[model samples]
Target: KLQMTREEVLHDIAELTSYAKEHYSTVLFSAEDATRSDLNFLIKANQIAVENGATRINIPDTVGTITPNAFGYIVRKNYEALPKNVRIAVHCHNDFGLAVANTIAGFENGASEAQTTIIGLGERAGNASFEETAMSLYALYRIPMNINTRKIFPTAKLIESYCGGKIKIGRLQPLIGQNAFAHESGIHAHGMIKHARVYEPITPELIGIRRSDEVEQIVKQSIKLGKHTGGHALKAKLEDLGIHPTNEQFQKIFNHVKSFGDKGHEVMEEDFLAIVKDVMGELPEEEQYVKIDELTVLTGSVTPTSTVRLKIKNNGDQIEKTASSIGVGPVDASMKAIVKCFEPMSKVKLLEYNIDAITGGTDALGHVSIELMDLETNQIVQSSATHEDIVMSSVLALLKGLNKIMKDKNSKN
Candidate 1:
């Protein structure tokens, strides 16, 4: 299947068509890499196959090398030239992530049938994914497909287990990726809980992935919660126990726990929520901290140096601070500098740092959150961020967590 000559391909299709006709009701002749081979040779070969008994002629763009317009044009031309009795089919690969696009084009142009496999599974990249194809046709192209959208995830899970590997859903992978249904903005989350269409194209549940699972799995996963056990995990725990916090309220509590965890300290729920109210109380009136001006970091030696200059205002009081320090690494040094300037009067100490990337490749962003313990009272603080720069994210997250912790503390009085 990997490599075959024109003669061999023709002979194989002829044999297959004969066998299919005798054994089954109808047959389709699929010439692999039909678009790449000499068109004249393929046309003659297909003609012979159809003459013998092939009910359909399939053209495959094996490498996703053709644009949709070209693909459609070719399929339409081929179908029109071929005998009326023979239907046309299109098979596409996703080498350039345009498999869906090409498939749509083929269908629109002339192909009545699509030869598709799940998740575009094939060699040297993959084939056109059945779920993505179906979703795109139904959702984007307004084409009708018989597939039930809800069956996608279960089908994928089964295939993945049988294949003995994981399906790496790219952050941009439509419909099924972890980030696909994620909403980071508070408004989006609130809207999703009320009605998913506010942010998601289709309710994740429509794909057999329930909202609870999506929330508890993907949302909590993003926050370093769930099985990975970070801030969202605490949030999950709190929610399960019927302890609900408003968006701003939870932000403060979560930041409290993340700060401590980032410093390497694991905490119990009693310790986790004790400082929640205190942190929530310190949040800025508009629910935003000083916008990060910039940070310069130098590390990879005995000691690391990090300098952060921030532009901030409390009420109407504007202030700026530039500080530097040498510590374990850029993240550590950055946090140290931020804590000194941003929360100089606070006594929170980072006890743990945990960072994980949801996906792979050089472009993936690290989702970081941490735990901290106030040196003065042992109260915990935590916070998290998704960023391409882990060190920078870590510093900003720490400051955010500290600010929340102080806010909640001040509010208690």
Candidate 2:
């Protein structure tokens, strides 16, 4: 219908309304670009449709060009000009980023229903978002809605997945985005630690989500270690990690972290923990039973092999031993060699070994966590180490766990 005249549109609507009334229980007459239509003619068209049996009239901002105040004014005009029995609905687009605003405005003035889509999925700039509209209505206007708030995230995720790139949720999108409830800054985290409401408009639990304290603490510690750090903050972070370093050890760890920051390197949590371990010494005095003197590994297309030299202390005497082994990989071979060297103490078996890159890039920190079982004592222990070399990190973690098991056995004896 190019250059549709008001009279022609009204004549068509009257005929459609009459036909719809006989066959359908309800009829809705939607005026495309209603905001731009002649107000007087628009009112007449709506009245004719309602008189002929249309149940509702919808006013849509087709190109999304109208302001909230203007939209409210138009809705108010239609509300007054139309018959008292007719219902009004508003369909708004987000070209001007005011669809929700205009929708709420129209509802506040007189509209009874709103037209919305999930995550504002529609043509061009899209339509008003149901989540935004429903949440705003309930939270800001005190309007009670029967929406299940907990299902909001799950539903949004399903829709987003089905869209398959047609719609992308903004990282900072309100309520459901990844960063919606994430706090990165130390100041913000500090405030949130005291009272979450200070930084968050609503708790994540209200939306069926749980806040990650470990992630938040990692961010807070990263910021402090990467930028300017205070003694209190540093102490708190170390204490949180269950590492109560002595005064001298604290000074060394702090200086090492600051040096890394000054060199333009990110001091991650793993890096800080590694620094603390290096400064405080690997094992406590009583737990110092076995130590790695030297290790060499050879791998690649050829058979993987390793040689390990270890120093074991017993009754103030140091005994050194060397062992060699072959396995599927460098880490496996190294573990076999270390176990061979410590065969006299206990039958130590590496039950589990896991490694993760703590940071990006080829020089990323490799964090190795291992679970060791002492078959002789039937005791299990877990420990971890972080380093740039995966094999060394794994060996160190295994040795740490072995030391714990040996220390416990000695204390019992």
Candidate 3:
């Protein structure tokens, strides 16, 4: 925006540096957008500043468009234009998400000092993140600095709080993110269980998280369970919850969990506990007299309808029953069809029905919770289920709650 001629620019540099020389002993002369300037003109301007008593020359990637190699070249050209004692510094921005790389490249070339900001906060896309750049030097380059590596996270958090929501550290921010040290994938989690180095480049302990060698301790602290769960990861999770199931029950729980992951839930600890409670709670496998064999629903034009097939065990007899019904919607239709299937054995009334999307998107996880009342015993019970399809979610939740009351009143007796 400063459309000044070459002579005017050189005159300003000389006058400012000279005035600064009279009062200040050390002066840093920064040529803004130096990367886009003519290399020779930039070098001459830097020399003039040095001649006028400036001790440092800074090359700023002012719109942050310069490549790493180009920035390194500019810093090198300027560094050689002055006395060896004149410090060469560089400022980089992350417009292209390469501030850290450009900073390191400048240092590798001739610039010894890099201007950076905390959590990469600054003008426009922000300056280089000091923690990330510094760690890159310490861990990858093996160059030791005066920085306290362990304090990096605490300092980042303090700065994040100071921003007060204006600037927030991203969850995926390297080294400082919540999932930065988390291992969730089944394969990766198993590898981490075997050797921390297998999946992690460096120990998370270096960045403030406590170190743990025991598998249980590590899993509890760093492992997360989700739809991608494997036998190893699930076993670790179960161990963390202090729940021990027989091999058969464990297999059953695992399969149920896999089915529950139809919409890719991370399976929070509470969710895991709930799933375990459902499996180990009363009406365990052998006594599960009613099970949904298959459920299908159709809606949107012709009257919303559903077909439900269930397997029933009545006092040592195995029977299959199918029912079709229509309702106000597909979910309601599915519920009605299920109710019709079980009307002969036990009658129940739905007290409440609630559904919420646990995640985002059209096919995200739909959590269905329902309250049921067994008409025969007048007992009220609550059950919930999750699936990718809303109709299936409603059907599963209804069946779960129905089974709870029916098992207590009609099945055992």
Model 2, 151-190: lDDT tens digits are 7777888899998896888887888886787554457656
User: Model 1: which ten-residue window has the lowest total lDDT?
Assistant: 220-229
The local distance difference test score of model 2 is 0.80
Cα-based lDDT for every prediction: 0.68, 0.80, 0.83
Least lDDT summed over 10 consecutive residues: which range in candidate 3?
274-283
Deviating ranges (above 4 Å) for candidate 1:
1-16, 141-144, 190-195, 212-413
lDDT of 1: 0.68
Candidate 3: which stretches are off by over 4 Å? 158-167, 209-217, 248-266, 282-284, 298-305, 325-333, 349-394, 401-413
For model 3 the local lDDT of residue 369 reads 84
Candidate 1, residues 171-197: lDDT per residue as tens digits? 656676666765544444545444546
Error of 1 at 371 (Å): 17
Best by TM-score: 3
Which candidate has the highest lDDT of all?
3
1 or 2, greater by TM-score: 2
Residue 79, model 3: lDDT of 71
Collision count of model 2: 0
